[model samples]
Target: MHMHVALCAVLDPSEMPGGYRFEAIENLVLSRLDRLPPFTRRLVMDPLGLDHPHWIEDPEFDPIHHIRRVSCPAPGGSHELGRLVGRITSRPLPRDRPLWELWVVEGLAEGRFAIVAKVHHSAVDGMMGAGLMVNLFGMTREPAPEAPPPREEEHPVPPEPRPSDIEMLKSAARKRLAQPRKLVDLAKRTVERVGGVVERRRDPELAHGGTPLTAPRTRLNRPIGPQRDVGFARLSLAELKAIKAAVEGAKLNDVLLAVVGGALRRYLAHHDDLPEVPLVATCPIATGAGRGNNNVAAMFVPIATHLAEPEARLEAIQAATRGAKEEHAVLGKGELLQDWADLAPTTTFSVASSLYSRLKLSKHHRPVHNLIVSNVPGPPMPVYLAGAELEAAYPMGPILDGAALNVTVMSYRGQVDFGFMVARDVVPDVWRLADAVAPAFRELRDAVLGAPSEASPERSTPAE
Candidate 1:
């Protein structure tokens, strides 16, 4: 069985009751659920069923394991968490059943709850995960606990195959030949996808983000890391839309990134540095068009808040972003990742990621991107499944050696939530980054609405 290759570095330290421990939080989340929903929970609790601290032996295994109740002593809170996550996520999943794990974390600044859950990329995609959150959530603080569903049917494990050298050669050749056909198929898909978005604007269900397609390069858009430092910012979507309306042709997404640009600009200016060139952001284009895995790819676009006026910043983002969509039209993601895979094998990729772990590292390698910025869509309406009301949602992403930061945002019914993950060594004050993002939004709102920024967008470069 192929372990779904997902690197959902599974860490987000949330503020909670100081006295609450890791197990308590896990139990709390677990208790909030109505019943142990058969098919899914069985998958989640498989490792626990075998009762092994390490379930590496199970042939039909669950790739994700959630360890809990960990602490960070003085001199290392976020750093320690970052280390722990890096160590856990960098290894290859054992050749077992399902892949994934959920860890309950403790010892954060505000007595927060940290969830480090990962799944094999193959088993669950991003939107599915987002969708699951709704069902998993409770509607109210004191939700009515529902009855649990019957347990799923369990079966015996199967044997694994040991391939010979000749078989491996044949497999490789076969996979290689399949590529040409895949490419041809992708070309046909390219036309179909183009028709879906632009020509088919009738399909409002299309998943989209604010920034444009053809963004300019920024100093920040460099190769990135396996270790990440994460932070979050929450805002009102209504207010954002109001600002978008105020500014002519200002899309809400453009306003969002312009706000980030303004914040990045200010953050950089404080350090007395600014890039002569604009920054580039690699945003995701969701391809859950009922296709196979990784139905997403990055759209490299420009961040222009560095320009003199907020209006110019928004316009720059729009122009550059539109161009980007046109280009992404022809670029199929399946082929792109194959090119990426050739550059980084799964094992070496796993080992290289080890450097980002709590352990030590070598100095010779570079990461794939400078930073990761993702914006995921959420239900416009509130949803409930288990019991507990879905209070809030935040997106988390992986970090590596070179790229110290990842910023992922998820917009729920009424609020837009932002999550920033960084390397503890690099961004010591993740909360401070949170502070930066909020004001960035306000500045862009004023600019979009023809209001004055509390402060102008300062000029700055990516962290040195």
Candidate 2:
């Protein structure tokens, strides 16, 4: 999917040492950009489609052009904020400047505020995006004293100038010269990987990974529009840990997958569209060894959404993920995915994607997978941005043509925040899906630790 990512951070100004003001927070966010390279760079594409685009320093970069302030609508709750975010993310970032934006949102409930940071998928993956935001924050509410100005000869290196068309063509020619050899290697590796998978299939104990074009069709597997519907859910990390501990050999990720599977099962059943077969989810794993800002590979897992019982689903997910990990280890870390990506020209992808969307080709073919579920690790301790106390954090991933729903979960200060981004037409009443997360958690918890003496109430999204 060609898409951008947005992370919403709800802030409490009451905890700010110097009190809250929009100008002060905006200025504080702007002051941190001097050290981030992606903020100051613009993408320069080859006019003749000879090679991939290049990131060059923008000589006319202006911080104000990228960051702006917006007031939430009436009620100033989760629904209002989600609508505002959906509108903000639906529009594409301008290609003429840096592929990023920061919106300082005011008028949230209780005198609080929010910071919505948007960055293109080309600029950062889940891990890299989280790191970029962490750079702007501090360990405490009190801002650390600024470092002294650099003395003579201590200045940073100068930014590179934009290259001319002739220079770019020459570079592309040089790169193309080595393509034949790399292409040969890519083919050999591809054959070997296929052979390995075939051999693995011979072993009865070794489970096979998910295959493309095999997923069951559903309402989510269709073409999507520019409009998006957003939903937020907050879960207790402690509860998740307890659930994980209940099942032998189950990881925290497996628990998360189980919760999502249960929720999807209920949602589909509610609509009377639940399929007999289990649903497939494309889980992204960060390799930390790939090229460019997005250094991640995908692993397809069969989420047991077809199962009726939550505990049974958790066990099934645990087994499936174990097999997936073993398969990934055998396949190696993203080398095959990267090599294939490198062999394709930038223009080919851009053109193919455009045609696919324009022609609505996805509706005529088998869906790659049902949806995308990403798990991003975040700060364990309470961190402050500028002077405001961080209350909630929700990160959203991009939705694809066939897979119009994306559920991205992030861990922050003992809380697991879930952000849901879906096509407006494909899935109306997104909050219905979000609201199901708590019951899913409780169902699993009750199965494991037995029903609590006192029932724990459902969790509402922050400021709702």
Candidate 2 regions exceeding 4 Å error are: 143-157, 453-458
lDDT of 2 at 182: 89
> Which pairs in model 2 have colliding backbones?
none
Which regions of candidate 1 fall more than 4 Å away from where they truly are? 1-64, 67-97, 105-116, 120-125, 138-173, 177-227, 332-369, 383-386, 400-402, 451-464
* lDDT over C-alpha atoms for residue 316 of model 2: 87
Q: Number of clashing pairs, model 1?
A: 59
Q: Which is the leading candidate under TM-score?
A: 2
Identify the leading candidate in terms of lDDT: 2
Candidate 1 worst ten-residue window by lDDT: 46-55
Clashes of each: 59, 0
Tens-digit lDDT string for candidate 1 (1-464): 12222222222222222333444444444443232221122222221122111122233422124334555443334445545545555454433443555555445444433455555554455566665555544344333223222222221223244344455555555655666777676567666765655653454544332333223333333333333344556777777777778767767777777777777777666655566656666676675455433466677666764685767888888776766665566455434544445433244555555544434332333224345567777777654322223334556665544445667777777777766666555665666666687777766666666664433343221110
Q: For residues 148-267, write the lDDT of model 2, one tens digit per residue.
A: 233321112255888998898898988899999989988988888767877886899877667667889998888988888788999888878878887789999999999999889888
* Model 1: residue 458 alpha-carbon error in angstroms: 22
